[model samples]
Target: MSAELTRLAERVADLERRLSATTRTARLAYSSIEDGAIEVYDNDGTLRGSIGVQPDGTVGMVAVNAPPPPAPAPALVDSALAGLDVSWDGQWANDEDTTPLDLALVQVHMTALADEELSEETMVAALVPGGGRTGVATGTYEPMWIILVAVNTSGVAGPPSAPVQGQARRAASDDILNGAITDLQLAEAAVTEAALAAAAVGKTAIQDGAISTPHMVANSIQGDRIAVGTLDGDRITARSITGSQVIAQSLTANELAANSVTALQLAAGIVDATHIKAGSLTAGLLAADAINGKVITGSRLQTAATGRRVVVDPERAEVSIYSGIAEEMQPGGLHADVLDLGASKQAGVSLSAPSLGKGTAYLAMQSPNTTGGAGSIRLEPSDRITEPGYTYLLARQGNSTTQELIESYASAPSGGKITVQQQTSAGFTWRTGTTSATLRDGVLSVPNIAVGTARVTPVADKPTSFRVAKRLEGKEVRAFVTASTTVPGTVVEVAATDADNTGFTLWVTRTNATATNVWWLMIGSDA
Candidate 1:
């Protein structure tokens, strides 16, 4: 068995040597082939295929396939907006007739920017050769933006067209535009509220009072438009303020002045339940005897669902009457701080009102029914009114100018009425208020410093002088001719001289002789 195995091993070694010899021969055959030529053969030496280098430097092999090379990319097109100019307002143009380049411009790309940065692009067809310049309207106000790029037939976008800052054609103001002015005609921020002049507005500017219901836009005049306190009696014309003018329940108690509204001012049959808001009118809002048995009628009282009408309670009525009487007795209806008067301070004598603030007071009358009453109440300062240091009384007749009658800190007997007087044709008649001193012959007997102003007619002569009714002390006199009947450019001068406690004299001089008027004012302590 060993001899047989050795024989098999020898056979195997022989086969290996033969295989090596065959590989060497194949390598030799492969190396001996001609330049760029290759041929494959079967075991029997029959030709199967051939391989050689072609003229193109590619290795050509029989029965071998290869993918074709990829196609080259197309070149970019050119763009040019030749002869660009502003043809009209918000429009631009390019010279289409001038054919500088052979390529036809199929389409043109336009890029516009405002403020030189923000940009918008648009595409437009190029007009044929010899056609009117290819134009485009920006449809906007003069834009200062540069057209970033414009492209043409070559398909290449050209550089920005010479930094064209477009300007819109301005319409000649001197010429008659004939067309109605539209918002487009105005520039941005034009026609602003601050730009409008005061004289441009107002009633005078409006023809035939056009600033009325038909002209005014609804909800245009808001509350802020009307200055506070401007909508008073004087500003609002008679019968001008209608029911629609007032807001629903907007008029509060504080807004309504005492006795400002009267029956004459109110429209007849307009004071019904529908007109007045619920819970708006209260008893405190009414005057002392605003509503009485005669004032209240069957139609005035509202009837409930059960047909029962509202009635005032006797207890409430009595309380209101007593409260009103107490308020009137108080000095100026102002609540005063209680002073430590020891036992001398009377219990029922002290009078005050909680609604009256310290620094303010109500003008009250001791006996309103008595036109010329003996009892008078003067205003007294409370602890809160300490800044002023002293109290003052201001008196004014119906539509007459208000005058500071008295200023003092002198106290009077507790609960004793202070006697005051109002100027009357007969003489100074006793009224419902107090002064620093008593009155005599229609004037205060005490040293009364008063300010008097009066218009004096100037004499046509050069030495024009007039005596004022009010007296002056220590030459405390001032005069000014606020208005005059003299012609324009006429110079006039007025002077106050010869001042005395009894009266003061006013002298005048005029450059151009003309009748004129002068006003004078004097301050003195002569009643």
Candidate 2:
């Protein structure tokens, strides 16, 4: 029996070892479940916890019991409760004559104490209700303990409630009531453009005619906002549309009414060349003195009808006129006003009028009247055929005054010749080099004459002569014997005679036969 018991024990031990090894292998093969929840159950088979997806599709651990979570603290009420009221009697009144005192009017004083400790010095007094989570008006935002006490009608204070700790904060959106805020409650500039939502302000929000020039910002009312046919002449104030208000190039002929714009309505210098349409302005459209003081700037002022133009070139500082004459007319044509040209120094005025060989080109200065005063002085081309390139100056000093004529002719490749004549008694004077010659009252007086010396061989006791290089007709000839090679102290005398235009004779009288030098002078008029 002992041997059998021993064998049986060994078998039991072997079975135990095998069972242990099988359990470990099963654990290693199935370490975790592929799907399904990992649930924990209590001894009674009640699910205590789970690590799996909940019904709301969230994967998290769930505590099924959670020990019934300690009873929750009382929630704060978001409203004020009614205050307790006490019945009171006036001073010296009987018991029947009692009055009910409203505790709300009795002023419940609330004090907010500092978080560190509660003291009188740290308490801020504010009037508030006691019950139903009433708030204490506190200036500070720090966490603090608030205590409240009710005052009786007799001004006696009641016992204070237990202090509650809280923090002062801004009222949330839920604390505000609908339509509680009004215009009077809003701060200045509190409602800005960004504060309004898109399309928040509708047409009904604005009153009729409430917006004025002061209220609307500049250029705020765009064209898209204005309804068609809404803005018209009657809607706009007179003279209110200034140049700055109008868009550039926006106003066309169709946009303007006839006679709508006038000088008074236009600003000074606002109308420029770009503003005016071509051929839009005419002589009749302008006032007679419209441009009197105004400056007209352009390249030229031209007449379309006559092809006359006056060009002013500012870069060159020059002015030129074409196909026209410039005349300054005075009232009644009797004023002695002078036409001034080239007022600046070194300035020149050129008057050129070519005849193209069809007529004469002359410069004439005439009197104002044809019948009186000094008549005219005319300088014109000479009419003499022999000197086609000659010019003459004729001065007619009226009917009572003498007329003077001066003629100038040029000989090709040589020099020029000038002739002067007086038609009356009055003559003129001419200066050449250091000598001056005057012709007056039909008499010519020359300060210097042509005097020359010539040697002549005289026949024995006879006259001898030589031809004068210059014509001596209509002249006085004077001859004198300067020296003689004849016998010394032989008494020689010279006489000028037979003086014609071409030649002259000089007679030498000497007692001996010898040559004599005679000096002769001739004074006459050049005709």
Candidate 3:
């Protein structure tokens, strides 16, 4: 079996060698070729079939048969829709000569079955050219519902017309007689003014009261045109006589009845001052609140009497009593002799000034004689004997306008703490003799000597020193020293040293070692 297998393997090798030689020398033809294209031809070399990229770059195959021709463009039909009439030949018979330029085609959609209910899915569409007509294919006399849609060249369709019924037939103008179209047959406003000849409508043509105001042009009727007594109150419409219709100054008092020209009859702002007679309008003629918010100018209230005219200036919100005529009053503000506010317990006056400034309330007293007494502002309690606490009068100091002297009375009994204070940075002064004594910063200074007492302890038989509280300007300080306890034979001495404007120093001398407590009296010139 091994030998037989070897023989078979040798035969296979021999067959492969023969096939390799044949493949090298012989050519193999393929029934179909792939790279982009393949063409089949007869012996005449005419192309019969091909599978290749077409001229449009799409891969396709073609046989001897050609593709079907594309569908023809839809035909156009001219017909009138429902509620519209067309000629017998199905042409639009409208008076207009122009047609839509963009109307390229019309699609005629009709119900498919004779009695079938019409819907979009059940209807069959037949396209036609715009304004062209075609006959229906129905044999029976039954009506077929149809709808027409206008299509442009871009295949865009406009809204469909109303569905039409029955065949496409309409009565022509030639079929109707001359007077057959009556008013009932014509649509509303069919015959306009332009359709009638000039002066064609005479008095007999219009019925009585048929020609209303709207039928006549504005201001067309004149007095001369109307017969006398032809137009009376019943003939004229209410408010029909406008301002332009009435001649200027023609309507006098006799022309209108009394109280006839009321507010309702007159236009707003038409009755100006020129139309109104002076002094003709009385208080009874005006409404109660007619002048509630109205402005009255000062010129309207001028008077000849002096000190009797009161001028109220609305702009300044001020009322001034004038002592003379209107021309004598000041132009800007109130110029009056006096402004007297009548006695009222609740009414109090207030005056304000700018910041960092003082407001002054002046009182000028008329003295009977130059010697003494004058009218003064007396401040007293309303119900009690004493005035209220902190109730004081403020007055500017002599020759200094900014400095004020205040004398405040306490709220206590008669002997209470009444104090006098002054608003000054330079302190207060008390003038008695030829010189004045100034008290500043809790320190009392005098032109003469100031005396005070102090206690000091001195070292035994040693000279000791201490400071004095009183600030003295002069160095002339005289001091006396004595032992605080009763010492029989103790000698002590006190002397002032280092005297300056602020303070002074006092020195003490004691002879006995047992004596320490020393009392001293200092007298110094403070000024």
Q: Pick the candidate with the highest lDDT.
A: 2
Compared with the true structure, what per-residue lDDT tens digits does model 2 show for residues 1-527?
99999999999999999999887785647566333346566776445566765545677666552221111112231222211111111121123422234333222222344324433333344343222333434333444454444443333444343444555555577678899999999998899989999999888999999878878887888889999999999989877778778888999879999998888889777899898999998899988997799776655443343435554555444444454333321101111222322111121222223233333344455552422334445555533435546544555543332234454546444535454544345777664333446778777766534555555666766665554444443444443335534356654567776654554566777675665656677655443
Off by over 4 Å in 3: 1-124, 127-181, 185-191, 229-242, 253-259, 267-527
Q: Which regions of candidate 2 fall more than 4 Å away from where they truly are?
A: 1-267, 276-299, 302-345, 357-387, 392-407, 410-416, 419-428, 431-437, 440-443, 446-527
Q: Which lDDT value does model 2 have at 228?
A: 98
Report, for all candidates in order, the number of backbone clashes: 5, 0, 9
Question: Mind sharing the TM-score for model 3?
Answer: 0.22
Q: How would you encode candidate 1's per-residue C-alpha lDDT over 1-527 as one tens digit per residue? A: 99999999999999999999897785666565344456455565333445775334677554211111111111122222221232212112343323323222323333345324322224433433222244443333334333323333334433333344543343356444657567788887678668897778776766985556665666778888998987778766678665567898898778889998888888767689887889998988998876555564333222232222232333322111112333333222222222232212211122333333334333432321122212334444443434544443433222122211322343333222333334444344333243344455555543224443333444554656656545334334343333344365553667777666666566766654554555454555323
lDDT of 3 by residue, 1-527 (tens): 99999999999999999999978873745455443456555665344455785434678765532222222222333333221122122223233423344445555656534344433333344434434444543322334555655545434555454555554334478767999989999898799889999999888888898977677888677788989888889977888776668889998899889998877998766787999999999999989999799866654243434554665555544444443434442322231222222211121122211111212222222211222211122232222334444233323233211223333333554433332334256577654323456677777766545554444557777887767555443446555555555665564576766655444676767775542445554555533
Q: What local distance difference test score does each model get?
A: 0.43, 0.50, 0.49
Top-down lDDT ranking: 2, 3, 1
Q: Name the top TM-score candidate.
A: 2
Better of 1 and 3 by TM-score: 3
In terms of lDDT, the poorest run of 10 residues in model 3 is 340-349
